[model samples]
Target: MQQRKQQLLRRHRQRKRVALLLGLPLLFSSALWFWWLPLPLLLAAWVLHEAYFADHLFYAPGDDYDYRFAGAGVSVSITADGRLGLAQLEGIAEADTLLLEVTIKADWRGCWVDPRVLIDVAQPHDQQTFERGCAGRRVVNLSGLGPALAAGQVRLRGRYCRLAGQATLHVLRNPDYACQRMLILAPHADDAELAAFAQYQRGAEVTIATLTVGELEAEPYQQLGLSAIEAARLKARLRSWDSRHAASWGGVPAERCFQLGYFCMQLPAMRAEPLLGHPSKVAQTGDIRPLRKGNALPLPGDVDGQPSWFNLLGDLRGLIEHYQPQVIVTPHPQLDPHADHQATTAALYEALAVSHHQPQTLLYYANHLHDNDRWPMGEQGEGVALPPALEPLTVAGVWSPSLSGAAQIDKSMALGLMHDLQTPLPGKKKLRRVLQHYLAGRRWPRWGVDEFYRKAIRRHELFFVQPWPIKDQAQRPE
Candidate 1:
């Protein structure tokens, strides 16, 4: 409340400053000739001064926060700290990475100063800074945070701040991203998990990859009126968020995961098809990918100027050749809804066919295809049912390992770690509604969130396999 009062004072001063700037020029003219001009000028100043009262920022905070930094102009939280510090977090000390969850309110109509997370690392006396784009928020993990935690180098010291925004912090608990020699691919950041995380365990090598950078070149952010710099920063931040997702969820070493860096929302052009309506606007612009301070660009051979379809195919082929994964899991090309998802499946299929190591198995998953279904997710035919197009694929066997209750918690943590991507934008109203019901299931102990996750933890994760053709489902982990 005190801080808000201060911000109000500052805003008042700022408005007054602007009012003075506008009025002084006219008043000076009036002093010289148009004395009556001051009357209208003062009225304009008053109108502007009173306008600030209507600014609207609102958000929900968790139990961890004791204060409400509620305001208009885009910030609402139940758990916000005045001094900016970590919330009540425990059991995450064992995690290689941790996610700090928060909620935010953005103006949705103007440029917002991207929120920043600063972490003070131990012994090395180093500082890592991350920009958290203005959405109902999520924490930015510090560079080397996972290794630092695993190595017992230091306890993290953190703070959050954003210009033209307000944030409330929450917690995404411990995630054990364990795997050995497992390679998973998703067109988007979270898809890898939703698509393939049904059967993961620790103590194995794991490599996770995303086909696109997951920034629709900030089309949504721009629609929300962010500046170019702000948009780019958000893209880079999202990349970082996915990087953390790999480390924390895949339980693989950070270097093992990779992003293919395709321009988002524009894959149709690569498939010899028209661009999606959303990304079509940026199809011609070569600068859609985020170019951040530490982020890298695609190699010349992998992605051409506009990142064509052939380029995506080449990259997927190269990745398969390099990883030589025995079991390749990806989306069912014929069933997914998003253009990029379909493209990824197609590219992966082509890459595998063309690659030297044909791998032991090809498991095709279909989750996004059923989003609009009335039954919701987490079933073989109802929530997570396969499209008839993929009926022949998983006919051999589905390798869904029974997730122990404890394992379920770990999966939840992994899913929670992905809160950044899960945090919805105005455009994701439908998704939010789904999640709301999903979360409600957790509360009701009915066919809900628990049931949804139970699908992944089921006795088998459904997949289509052919004996020699698909190589007889890759040896399932015991």
Candidate 2:
């Protein structure tokens, strides 16, 4: 307890130091009555500092899936020509691909310019720009620099920034997604697109199986002057349409998209009570059925689906057996904090266990990483490194498939088509609704608040790849 208190005291002191340094300027610049500007300014600066700088504790300090800085650095130096050269690269020839991680020191100057690290890869004539914000870190794949790295000729170029301490190099195996039969298991609409649209859209045989219609949401819809149930029903229908059409837009035909009409936010309850049926929290119904695009596999037992674990698992197993997919994409149960996301993968594990089915690769993604949506920290359209995360021990590999500028725009457009992704339309009661939303402490997407698109339309998509049937006991439930 004493040690804990000491740690807290240290953190508090650090925060106070930062607050005073930032807050004093505003206080000095303001009038007598406005002298209190420092308090709110201090709060805003502190939040941004924690989100972009501090490494010991991220946004979720006490949560199970909170991330920590797990980078290992090697000393490097820049030449007079401003080319960063690391001598250590010559000795490390084990992996063909590596992740170059660079950290920016936190301070006023570093935060102001938002430095961009420009790396020029020889042989391939490739260039990558890593965007940095206030003491933030970024990673870039070294696959394109394979020839130069093997010959100990790796060099990096940075613009308007100084190194924090040292840069890290993480060796990783790249997973091939070309022409593979891929199955995406999405807990809700837009998840498949958010996670892997750029990856599977071009060269892969993609089949999207959405677990729920997301009928539990009634917020922005209720602002449309509909009752709660009416809003829920409308949202379900529109999102179902969005899922199918969005997939279709990505070269996946409408015939390939499927929605297993389960209600949102109910999967965990279904898992806990396998035999019992649970109704939707908003729609207030227990009917669960498959909305098929084309005939595939029938749900076992009753024709009318029951919102039970048995039926959910049966449907999942049936889909797997029919598809025989080489790659299965779902959320990482350990990293993603959403209950539905964790439950979706949990059901997948159980289904694979019973059917004895094994895929070549199980790609895991985290849409909700307990980090308060502040991850992948950069401008839209920039390359995304692995977020500063406590690495999961059982991951077989880490893959980041790059997207062309056109593909990123296409993804942004596809996300725009989703009804839920549509920002709330201006209405007569706009001000009142905005005030109500704020008072209720609910996050409603206003115009230009496209958090999903900002995070999704990156230069590359990241996934933790695992081989199945997973042999790692730590990855599976006891």
**Which candidate gets the maximum lDDT versus the true structure?**
2
For candidate 1, write residues 1-478 as lDDT tens digits. 2233346457656875785787687788776777677788776555433332212222121112122111211122222222223233343343332333343333322122222233334443322222222333333322224444334444433334332223432222212223424567777766666555545445366667676655545655665688765665566567546653455554555566666656666665667642322232333344323321222334333333345666566666776677777666776544455666667766776666677766666666665442222112222211122222212222343332223456555555565555334444353434443443443221112223433343443322344432224443332210
Q: Whole-model Cα lDDT per candidate? A: 0.45, 0.66
Off by over 4 Å in 2: 1-97, 111-116, 120-138, 142-161, 164-168, 290-296, 390-394, 425-449
* Per-prediction CA RMSD (Å): 19.8, 7.8
Task: Write candidate 2's Cα lDDT for 172-195 as tens digits.
Answer: 545476478889999998999999
lDDT of 1: 0.45
**lDDT (C-alpha) at residue 388 in model 1:** 23
